[model samples]
Target: MRFNVWKRLELAAVTVGIAGVVLVGCAAPDEAGVSDARVAESFAAMYTQWLTEPDLTEMDRLVLDEAQRTGRVTQGQYQDAIDRLVSCMADAGYALQLTTYPSGVIEVQPPVAVPDGDDLMSSKHFCEKTTSIYAIMGYEMQQGNPELYADPAVVAFNCLEDADLLASTATVDDVKRFMYSSERDNFPFDSEDFGVKACFYGAGMAYGTVAEAE
Candidate 1:
């Protein structure tokens, strides 16, 4: 089965910072096509871009807070863990770039905020919202060629995870609201009426599915 190498690598890149799987906002697959090498290069580029941003502080704090809440680390260790995450990303990015993967053009928009009045840190909320969005992409791909890809529902669930970070450097509440609103409004697919197929078509990915594009 042709695996959507880009999507898989995208999942790896975003979740690499955390201990578990995590999802960031969605991005349209590259029109130029995808390959394992390209995916690695794209991931490296994305990771590098993410690291350069100052907004990552909120994500760092969120990770630390969760660690403390779970008793995984003492307060004094928070900074250390945060430092480790950065180092990890740096190392991972470098490693991915070292591969002989080909390059592709994949455009990802910043996440749109969707106001669901849900808790920002709620795993359920993040999963449900992201799953809904990913499901659409999966469905569209399947419609084009079922044998080409795996189940969209399964991929969406496995690939996407809750993110406790935000961009504005604002209060957690403000950041949460902004993220939620962005996801709701700016989703590349039209989620209105929850039409997964329609949204996929709208994304202009209907001609080909994102299933492993080997």
Candidate 2:
């Protein structure tokens, strides 16, 4: 399973050349010394907390209604989307523990120059991979259970969007600090590995290490 997951991730890196548009801003200079462990812990805690909070509120309903009326999704599809969203929230805890934290599986090499755009790209790809897994599960759910909702790509994109928004709250400086630590601990996967792009791809590959373990 781990091999397969990594294979898929490598394929994604090669084929999915979509430029990462999500920008997690930089941390303030004062926060530069923060540790990677702390950043990971903070993200895990906040993500778990966010999952516990109710998400399908009045605004969500209104958005669904609008999407239905506009024919973006049928009423049935809207309900299915809601169900998938709920399930994603519920699974956040296991996903964080299994795919994110163990052994610092999500590590990235630090940028020599501050405000490296690759850092944000790494985050975007990380979130996208998580959503892709959920999307696949959604597809399987539809085939096995008629009552379940699917539209895997749509759900995945929604998940990606939501994650992007959530990541914006993290202090960028702290994230960079963590990257530096990771670089210090695990640098130059090879002499050929060069620049932020290599580091970003490495981080992207690292994203699902925990999930593959499970």
Candidate 3:
């Protein structure tokens, strides 16, 4: 296996910082074209890029299409999340970075972890959002190969929890709307619909956290 050795190493490395599995994003099979080393490199590069180039508009453009394609979020919901996230970041004086992992997962690190920032993510609400997103990702990948990863329904549950947190501030209805919209947009990819759902669930969870904080 190309990633057998590297996978072990990456897991160990990540475990040292053990923020715990907060979000469960989709992960590809071990046979996915991208090698394990490639996955680690990609994750690191993406993380760095997100930190250096923190633009809300760019994030919206890049993530919205993917979210829509996978039924992760509706365009309107995406916009709302974006607005809410940006506002939260501005208010908290923090930034966000989305790091893609080879396990077909994407991990998010708070802005406070950056060179100069304060950590305001200790709130219970923030933790719920983080874990929910990861579960959502897990769910998305599970639909395709449930045994290969963690439970997909966990993603849904976490996303739901995160949405509840945001309900006090923003309209939680939009979260469901975005997910349905994402499902409608990705109608063609039937077999991979589960994967899409997982992805969207992650998106919803992540966005919900921002909305709640805002």
Candidate that scores best on lDDT: 3
Where does the lowest 10-residue lDDT sum fall in candidate 3? Answer: 1-10
Tens digit per residue, CA lDDT, model 1, 112-146: 23243243224332332322222222222223222
| Better candidate by lDDT, 1 or 3 | 3
**Mind giving the per-residue lDDT tens digits that candidate 2 earns over 1-214?**
1112221223122211222212122222235333212111222222222223233344334433443334232334434443443345344321111222221222222222336455434553444343333222222222221221112222222222333422344444433333334433222122122222222222333222323346
Residue-pair clashes per candidate, as listed? 15, 3, 21
My TM-score estimates for the predictions, one after another, are 0.18, 0.18, 0.24
After superposition, the stretches of candidate 1 with alpha carbons farther than 4 Å from their true spots are: 1-46, 58-117, 120-214
- Model 3 over residues 60-161: C-alpha lDDT tens digits? 444434543453433344334434544555556655454443334443445423443224443323533422322232223323222222332333333434
- What residue pairs clash in candidate 2, if any at all? 26-173, 27-172, 27-173
Residue 99 error, candidate 1, Å: 30
lDDT of 3: 0.33
Report the Cα lDDT for residue 133, model 3: 27
